[model samples]
Target: MSDATSRKVKRFSESDRNSEFDAATQKALEEIDVCQNEIDSINEKSSEEILKIEQKYNRLRKPFYEKRNNLISNIPNFWITAIMNHPDLSALLDETEEDCLHHLTKLEVEEFDDIKSGYWIKFYFEENPYFENSVITKEYHLDSATPTSESTQIIWKEGCSLAQNVEANKPGKKRRHEPAKTFFSWFNDNVDPYTDDIAEIIKDDLWLNPLQYYLVPDVEGDGENGVDAEEVSSSEDDEEREGGEEESRNQRK
Candidate 1:
């Protein structure tokens, strides 16, 4: 046999062939795979458990918000405060819409453990004669940052909360498309419930920001240009970081 071939062949007694180190290394690799699988299983179980708890908590939450229905709003301009607290989402709000969003009473989000149903937004509004309903609920089938309108659908529902007596005066008949020009007009249009699915309804971004998009002004939104401002701000931040890195490198010299 060639020298290399002879070297490659090892007997069981050889130190390198059956060494404890080699056995330990093999065992460690196997253990890593086992650990990874264990972690995955645990995470899956944990998520299910968390979702269960969320469902239970949501049950308690619903009644609490429902109690406020038809009652005077105690939280003054809650939507405005919520939006301003979040930088990125606030950037999406225009001056006009921000003022109009003050009337937003309650914004509830529904989460299904099953990823198929996706997430739902249930908006509770104060009585306004301008639109057909007070609550405009929509469910969007979005994954990550991409809106999967085909895989699922944006199931939209309008809730009439005019306390029966006031329902007769609902003004959707005359100026059919008038108030839509004002703030919250966007909600009146069921054709495209979102401002822009690709830009505004960034599913993951809202989740990350804890529903900052819900701070969306109660009026028709005017921040179609806000996304550009956000992009500029982000690019500026990146440049600042790069400049800091260059300064550090120069200091090292």
Candidate 2:
């Protein structure tokens, strides 16, 4: 037998119980707990400092975000395109919802005055046949590290309810246990705030850096031509600006 396998291991009987450690070992364990408490205290302070830092940057980013929204508004269907490009958000969208999202003009995320309190996700839409409301907002409020959310009720047009169109658990269907909720249904369902994947994905991923997703299709098409992604994205911005200027010039003419 190999030395590793041949080695005899000590096996203690179940009755071999010691409720107490030797004095030195017990003292050392107490000291270790004290050290861990100190470490935890440092971590708590660091978290507060980090939140202050985020609040500072968030204020600085506001004007740039506003300018970005203005610029993107010149690019038709910009919000819908970006939302569609996101893998997580795209999976939730069906063709019916995609049609509705085409009218989405702007998307905004705003943190509460107290950065730790929570944030809001706002979707602005042009006057569309799908819904009468001009905007829909979902706010996630954090209370003692627990999250809760509420959203604006959609005043959907007559006979144009996207949520009602979702088909689930039908016999003879290819996917019998398909998800009943469409992307539109997200506005209403808040059963488990912790498991609200759509809100989490949107707030964490898409809201942080939407420009990357906005240029996804352009980057894919330009990859074979040896064109840089940044260059393509820059060109897209330039084109949108020029298009806006041309529209203005035409109005004057």
Candidate 1 residue pairs in backbone clash: 101-218, 183-219, 183-220, 184-219, 184-220
Candidate 1 to truth, TM = 0.40
* Candidate 1 local Cα displacement, residue 175, angstroms: 35
lDDT per residue, candidate 1, 2-97, as tens digits?
343333332322554556667767556545655666676789899988877877776776665555432424656655566555545465455655
lDDT to native, each model: 0.49, 0.75
Off by over 4 Å in 1: 1-21, 68-90, 98-106, 113-117, 124-134, 142-253
Q: Per-residue CA lDDT of candidate 2, range 99-118, in tens?
A: 99999999988989778887
Model 1: ten consecutive residues of lowest lDDT: 160-169
Task: Predict model 2's lDDT versus the native.
Answer: 0.75
Candidate 2, after superposition: displacement of residue 190 in Å? Answer: 1.0
The segments of candidate 2 whose C-alpha lies over 4 angstroms from its true place after superposition are: 1-19, 165-180, 218-253
Best by TM-score: 2
